[model samples]
Target: MPIRVDLLALEPNVPGRACLTVKKWQGGEEQLEFSIQRNQDGFYLQDQKAWSNNPFWFKVSRFALAASGEALEAQVGPEVVDPLLEGGANSQFQIELREQNLGHADKGVVRPGVGLLPSTAGGQTRSTYGGVDLSAPVVPEPEAEIPELPELFLPVAEPEPEPTPAPAEPVYTPPPAPVKKSKKGLIALLIVVLLLLAAGIGYWFYQRTPAPAPTVAAPAPAATNAEACTLDSMNSVPELTFVQTCIKAAPDSAKLLEIINQAKASKHCGVAQRLYANRAQAGDPLIANAYAREYDPKYLKASECFPTADNATAAYWYETILAQDPNNAEAKQRFEELQK
Candidate 1:
């Protein structure tokens, strides 16, 4: 026989909350809590608080069930759980059980009662012999009859039904007249003539335009001091003269910022350091250390000279300076101060 599981009650009052308490035959107890919400789609259980406007928002606390054989206990809530079944029948197991349809609007607390087995059943023996005690308080009747009542009669006041709406008049559509093949043929000929004319005009223009004087690019300007100071020159030059020229060309703070950016991009730490120092001397802290100091001392000193005793900033500069010039008394003292 096919096993049937029915949801006896689903109470969806107390919106935004759900809880279930179950007592197992082995004398174990479990509790579960969950939230409920509703949306345009349908009712659903949420792990967190659901909105008040949720149409499906309802709280369900208690549920009742009736089965053919022994009464089974189950944990209920938002979480899914495997159903308890009889005779070790895995196929009969119903999973993810939840209560349903006490009413859509009946949101309230439920305290379901669990029927207990009678003590006389082999004096609470492990195996209750051949048949289970149907009289047990835990097992309740599966069906209860609800009588239907006759409707009350009332004095009738008859009213005529409204007339049906008239159908709309149909619109008359005229069929398209057939085109003259002669006219179509003439139009086709004209289109072909226009295409040929366009092609002829294109060819004439192409021939008239002397192939754009083979654009002879002007010879590149002889490598000047400015061009020579490129990233490639940083390693070749002993003192970074190109970098100094760049600084000279950079007339104001705005230009200085640009030069600093170029130095950083080239990975010219030493040049970047000097650029920062220049910016610091000019009182531009934002540019000095922001890009340079994270590297070695040459970069750090440039950053240190910039005003601003920001602890993290000072720490990096002081550490870098001390690492390179351990004997430099000023650097050592600053390192010690920053460490503290």
Candidate 2:
């Protein structure tokens, strides 16, 4: 069965997804472009169907890393996927195709409606911001009125004559006395009017009052108790936090590169490889020499520990050396050797 390789590493990228590029090699020893995908529970290079092909060997292979993610200048967090269990070898973890064909044999069953891993903030915080509401407040337009039609003229009908009425007796009529206004009633009316007037004025002031100034949210404080990365902390796969600490501690420590290239940095290989890659790209002879000292197969195959090669980086450093001093025999020799 066809197999695909995934090399996980830090890079500058959009959060909430992994950025990956799938490369295909062709005739003339050219590596052609394949698919590039942003994985979220999806495999790179190949799809679920390709992975499902029966009779294929399944292996975790290596936790190979490239100087990606952080190299792209992405901020830390939304951790990298680690394939190892406690003290498990990234390379030693493997199995026959067996029942692994249709899906990941070792992967945990996270059902479709499964809940997210719990945290201090409960479930993941969703975005509070969104596109403008369809019903957002706006100045309302006046409703249109239909035009009135002119009334049509009509003829009036004649009325019939009324019959004579019988005689009726007269009734006495009484005159109404002058109305005397009570002093208490007048006072009460005046008080009510005054109260109403006062209330109206108060309402007017309240409406005219401006809304309180909008408050700005304060920035959260920096975390103090960040995980410390000692040589002892190299047991587990290095996460973004560990990578960040290594960066801040020694942005360019050749000694650290030596440890990492030799696999002495242990599983912190990703972090060390990243740091070394940065220096290797600097094109400085001293830096290159320091790096090449460890990347050389003589030190120990860097590819054995890390998924990538420092030898591939050697050409750049050697070329940089040649550019500075064309007559430099050692640089020329190494550059020529790498070319072969």
Top-lDDT structure, candidate number: 1
| Candidate 1 segments whose C-alpha is farther than 4 A from its true place | 1-238, 251-258, 289-340
Estimate, for each residue in 50-100, the C-alpha lDDT of model 1 and write its tens digit: 323333322334332324323333334322111111111001111122234
lDDT of 2 by residue, 142-198 (tens): 875434333433333334345345347655535333213344555667787677767
TM-score versus the correct structure, for each prediction = 0.20, 0.31
Candidate 2, residue 115: Cα displacement in angstroms equals 32
What's the lDDT for residue 48 in model 2?
27
- In lDDT terms, how accurate is model 2? 0.36
Clashing pairs in 1: 12-107, 13-59, 13-107, 13-108, 115-138, 116-138
lDDT of each: 0.37, 0.36
Error of 1 at 1 (Å): 91
Query: Candidate 1: TM-score?
Result: 0.20
